[model samples]
Target: MAEKPRLYYFNGRGRMESIRWLLAAAGVEFEEVFLETREQYLKLLEDGFLLFEQVPLVEIDGMKLTQTRAILSYLAAKYKLYGKDLKETALIDMYTDGTMDLIFLIAMLYFKPPEQREKETELVVEKAKSRYFSVFEKILKNHGQDFLVGNKFSWADIQLLEVILMVEELSATALSKFPLLQAFKARISNIPTIKKFLQPGSQRKPQPDDHYVATVKKVLLM
Candidate 1:
C-alpha cells in the first residue's frame, strides 16, 4: 500500500516562503499550515508529533523535518528540481544558503529596537547586502539570465524571489539599486508556475504571514 502524503507548513513566518515556492514550482501536493500567534504555534508543538522547537517544519508520515534550507534541499532533490549534476547541485545549495543570510537580516530588523536600529541596520546594509549583492551581480552577469548557476530554473533562482520580495518590502530604493536583481525578480515573478500560485484567491488557508509587518509599522510610527 502507498503511504500517506505528509503535511508541509510555515509558522505564520516568512522563513518558509521559499520552500513553499519550491514545492509549488515542482507541482507538489502539500498543505501550508500557518499559526497566527506564539501561543498557537506553541500549542501546535505540543498537540501533535511536532516537538517544541521552531516553525517552518514538515511532518511526513509522522516524521518531523526542521530547518528551512534542509527542507528545501529534500523537496528539490526528491522532486528532481534540484539540478542536473553534482556541480549544479552545489550551486543550488550555495545560493540557498546565501538566501538564508538575506533572511536572517530581515528577521533581525523585525525585533530590533529603534534606539539601536541605526547601528544594527548599518552593519547589515553595509556589511551584508552591500557585500553579497555585488557578488550576485557578477554571478548573474557571468552565469546568464538565470540568477545562480546557469540559464535554467533551479532552487537558487526561486530562493532569491522571497528574499527580493522581502527586501523590496523593506526599502525599494535600496532594492532598486541592483537593477538586474529587480529585473531578475520580475522575471521570476512571471514564471508560469509561480504566477499560478500567486493568483489572488488561489492562495488558500492563509497568506504569507509577515513576521515583521506589524513590528515595522510600530517602529515607523514611533
Candidate 2:
C-alpha cells in the first residue's frame, strides 16, 4: 500500500476537484475513491471495511479527515500554498465563500422550474454575480498577482475559477460585464499546475448529474 493521502469524494468531481488540484500541484500521491452512483454509495456503506465517515473523507495514513473545503485548506496550509501574509489568508476565505455562493445560486436557479426561475432570478442572479464578483474585482484591483490572495497561487484562486466556469457553463455571457474578472480567470487558468489539472486527459471533465454540465449540454442541443 502506498503511503499517499487518500481522498473519498464524488466521482462526478464536484467540490472535491480543487482538492485534487492541490494534491496534483504538490505532486502528492493519494487514493481517489469516487462516488457518483447511489449503488456505489450504498455498496461503500455496506462494506464496513471502509474507514472514516463521509464521501469526501481524506485519510492521512492513520489520521482520517473529512469535509471538502477543510481538506483543501489543510493541504494548502501544509504545503505553504496558502500565501505569505495572514491578511492574504483572510481574503482567501472571504473570496472562497463568496465564489461558493455563486455556484450555489446557479444550482438553486436551475432546480427551479421556468416560472420559478423567473420569480427567483429577479433577486438571485444580480445579487449572486455582484456579491461574488465584487470581492474578486477588488482582488484584481488591488493585486496584480495571478491569483486571488497575495502573490501566490492558492485554493481561493481555484475556487474562483470554478465559479467562473460554472457561470459560463450556465450563461455564456456570464462575465461579459466584467472584463477584469474574465481576464483574471484567463490569466490564472494558464498556471502550469492548473493548466495541467484541467487538461482533456484529466478526469475533471464534467458529468451528467452535474448541474452545470447538464445545463451546458441542454444549451448546446438548443
Candidate 3:
C-alpha cells in the first residue's frame, strides 16, 4: 500500500481547501497537520521543511510539495481529477488561473484598513462579478456542461467552488446573477466525498472572524 499524504496548513481553509477537496474526492486517506500558532510555523521554517516558506505543504511518498496551484495540479493528475486529456488540462489550467486572480483581489481587501475595506470590497466585488464571473458563466454555457473542463468534475471545478465559497463568506452575498456559476458550486458541493467533508464534525475549521474585514472594524474603534 502507498503511504498516505500529510497536509500542513493553518487551522483555517485559506489556500488548502481545494487540495482538501481534491483529496476527499479522490477518496484518499491523508493526515492534516494544523499549525495554529506563529511558533509552530516558525519552527517548521527553521527546520527547512517548507521549501517555499509557506503552508499548505503536503508530504507524500517521501516528497514535500508546496504552492497552492502546484499541489492541486499534482494531486489532480495523480488521482485523475485533472481532466481527460491535454486539451482539457489546458482549459482547466486557464480556469484555475482566472479563479486565483479573483482570490487575490479578495485577499487584498483583507489587508486594507477598515475605513477602506467597504469601498474596496464593493469595487472588487463589482469587478469580479462583471469580469471573472461572467467569463466563468460563459465558459459553462459555451461547453454546455456543468464543469469547466469537459463534462466531468475536475480540479478546476473544485478550485472554482472554493473561490465562490470564499467570496460569499467575505461578501455575505450569493452570485444570484450568475446562475450557471451558482449551479456549478452547488453541483460540486453535492459530490458524496465533498458533502462528507463538509458535514458537521469535519476537521475543517470555521472561517476566521478576525480576518482583515473584521480586524479593520476593531482597529477603528480603538
Candidate 4:
C-alpha cells in the first residue's frame, strides 16, 4: 500500500482546487489538512512547513511541495493527467501558466480593500475578460478540439476550467459571450470523478468572502 498524499490549504478551495479536481479525477485518495485559523497557518509557517510561506502545500512521495502550479503539474505527471509528449506538455504548461496569471489577478481583487474593490473589480473584469478570456477562446477555437492539448483531457484543461469558474465568480457574467469556453466547463464538470466532487455537500466550498480569506485579512491587520 502507498502512503496517502497530504494537501495543506485553507478550508476553502482557492488555489488548491485544481489539485483537488485533479486528485479526484485521477481517483487518487489524498488527505486534506485545512488551516481554519490564522494561528494554524502561522504555526505551520513558524515550523517551516511552507517553503514560500503559502498554502496549497502538498506532501507526496516524501517531498514537500509548494506553489499551486508546481503541485498540480507534479500530480498530473504522477497520475498520467499530463500530456503524452514533450510538445504537448509544453503547450499544457503554456495554458496552465495563462490560467495561473488570471488566478493571480482575481486573487488581487479578493484581497483588495473593500473601499477600492468596486473600482478594482470593474477594471480587473474588463481587462481580464477582454484579454485573458478572449485569448483562451481563441485557443479553443484554434485547437478545434475538446481539450486544450492533444485533444484529450489534461491538467491544462482542468486548470482552465477552474480559472473560468473563478472569472465567473468574480464578474458573474463571464461566460455569456464565450460559448466555447462555457462548453469546455460543462465537459470538464461532467467527468465522473469531478461530477462527484461537485455534488452538494461535497468537500468543495463556495468561492470568495469565505471564512478563511476573512481570517487571513484580519490577521494581516493585527
Candidate 5:
C-alpha cells in the first residue's frame, strides 16, 4: 500500500487548510507534522526539504512537493477531481483561483492589528459578498447544475464550499442574499467525505485564535 501524504505546516489553517480540505474531500488520509518551533522549521531547511524555504509541503508518491497551487493541481488531477477535458479544467482553474483570492483576504485578517481588526473584518466581509461570493452565486444560477464544471463534483466545487464557510465565519448572514450559494453550500457539505470532515475530532482546524496567531508569528519571526 502507498504511504499517506505527510503535510508540513503549523497547526492552524494557513494555505495548508485548503490542501487538507481537498484531500479529505477526495477521501485520502494523510499525516501532519506541525511546526511548533522555529528550530523545527530551520531543521527542515537544513535537511533540504523546503526548496524555497517555505512550506505547505507534501511528501507523497516518493516526491517532496512545495508550492500550494502546484500541490493542489497535482492532487486534483491525480484524484480525477480536476475535470474531464481541457475546457472543464480551465473553468475549474478559474473558479478555484477566484476562491483563493477571497481566502487570502480572509486569512490576512488574522494578522491585522487589534485596533484595525474590526474595521478590516467588515471590509473583508463586504468584499467577499460584493466581489467574490456574488460571482459564484451568478455562476451557480447560470450553470443550474448540482456541481460546477461539467455538472460533476470537481475541485472547483470544493474550493467554493471552503470559501463560503470561511466567509460565513466572519459574518453569519454573508450568504443570505445568495439563495443559490446557500443551497450549494448545504448540498456540498452533506457529501459523505465532507460531512465527516466537518464533524468533531477530524483533521479540520478551527478558526485561528490568539494562540494560533502567536505560534505563526513566533515560527516565522514576524
Candidate 6:
C-alpha cells in the first residue's frame, strides 16, 4: 500500500486547510505533523524542508512539496480533480485564485488587535459578499450547474465550498442573498467524501481561536 501523504504546519488552518479539504474530497487519507513551538519550525527550516522558508509543506510520493498552490495543483491533477481539459483547468485556476484572495483576507483577522477585529471582519465580510461571493453567485446562476467548472466536481468547487463556509462562519447570512450558492453549499456538502470530512472526528480543524492565534504567532515568531 502507498504511504499516506504527511503534512507539516502549525496546527491551525492557515493555507494547509485547503490542501486537507482537497485531499478529503479526493478521498485520500493523510497525516499531519503540527509545529507546537518555534524550535520545531526552525528545525524544519534548518533541515531544508521549507524551500521558501515558509510552511504549509507536504511529503507526498517521495517528494517534499512547498508552496500552497503548487501542492494543491499537484494533488488536484494527480487525483483527477483538476478538470477534464485545459480550458476547464484555466477556469478552475481563476476561481481558485479568487478564493485565495478572500482566504488571505479572513486569515489576517486572526492577527488583528481585538479592537480592530470587529471592524476588519465587517470589511472582510462585505468584501466577500460584494467582490467575491457575488462573482461566484453569478457564475453558478449562469452556468446552472452543480459544480463550478464543466459541470463536474473539480478543485475549484472544493475551494469555493471551503471559502463559502469560512465566510459563513463570519456571517451566518453570508449566503442569504445568493440562493444558488446556498444550494451549492448544500449539494457539495452532501458529497460522500466531503460529507465525511464535515462530520466530527475527521481531520478538519476548527476556526482559529485565541489559543490557535497565539500558538501560531509563537511558532512562526510573528
How well does model 2 score by local distance difference test?
0.67
Off by over 4 Å in 1: 1-11, 36-48, 117-123, 202-222
Query: Which 10-residue span in candidate 5 carries the lowest summed lDDT?
Result: 134-143
lDDT of 1 by residue, 38-83 (tens): 5655566676645446556677545677776677778888877777
Which residue segments of model 4 deviate by more than 4 Å? 37-39, 218-222
Worst 10-residue lDDT window, candidate 1? 203-212
Clash number for every model? Answer: 0, 2, 0, 0, 0, 0
lDDT against the true structure, each candidate: 0.65, 0.67, 0.77, 0.81, 0.93, 0.93
Q: What TM-score does structure 4 among the candidates reach?
A: 0.88
RMSD versus native structure for model 5: 0.7
lDDT-better candidate, 4 vs 5: 5
Tens digits of per-residue lDDT for model 4 on 64-176?
99988788888999988888999999988988887788777777676777889889878878877798788888989997999888988888877787778777777788778
TM-score of every model? 0.75, 0.75, 0.85, 0.88, 0.98, 0.98
lDDT of 2 at 147: 66
Candidate 4 has its poorest 10 consecutive residues by lDDT at 213-222
Model 6 residue pairs with clashes: none
Better of 4 and 6 by lDDT: 6
RMSD of 6: 0.8
RMSD after CA superposition, every candidate: 5.3, 5.8, 4.2, 2.2, 0.7, 0.8
Q: Which is the better candidate, 2 or 3, if ranked by lDDT?
A: 3
What is the per-residue lDDT of model 5 for residues 1-222, given as tens digits with 9 covering 90 to 100? 999999999999999999999999999999999999999999999999899999888999999999999999999999999988899999999999989988998898999898999999999999999998888888888969989889999999898999999989989999999999999999999999999999999999999999999999999898
* Residue 136 in model 1: lDDT: 77
Runs of candidate 5 with Cα error greater than 4 angstroms are: none
Model 3: lDDT of residue 15: 73
Question: What is the C-alpha lDDT profile of model 3 across 1-222, one tens digit per residue?
Answer: 888899987555567766777788777878888665567777878888888776678998788898988888899998988878789889888888888888777766655677998898888878878888888898888878777777888888877887788778766565988889878888899988778877888765566545523433342232
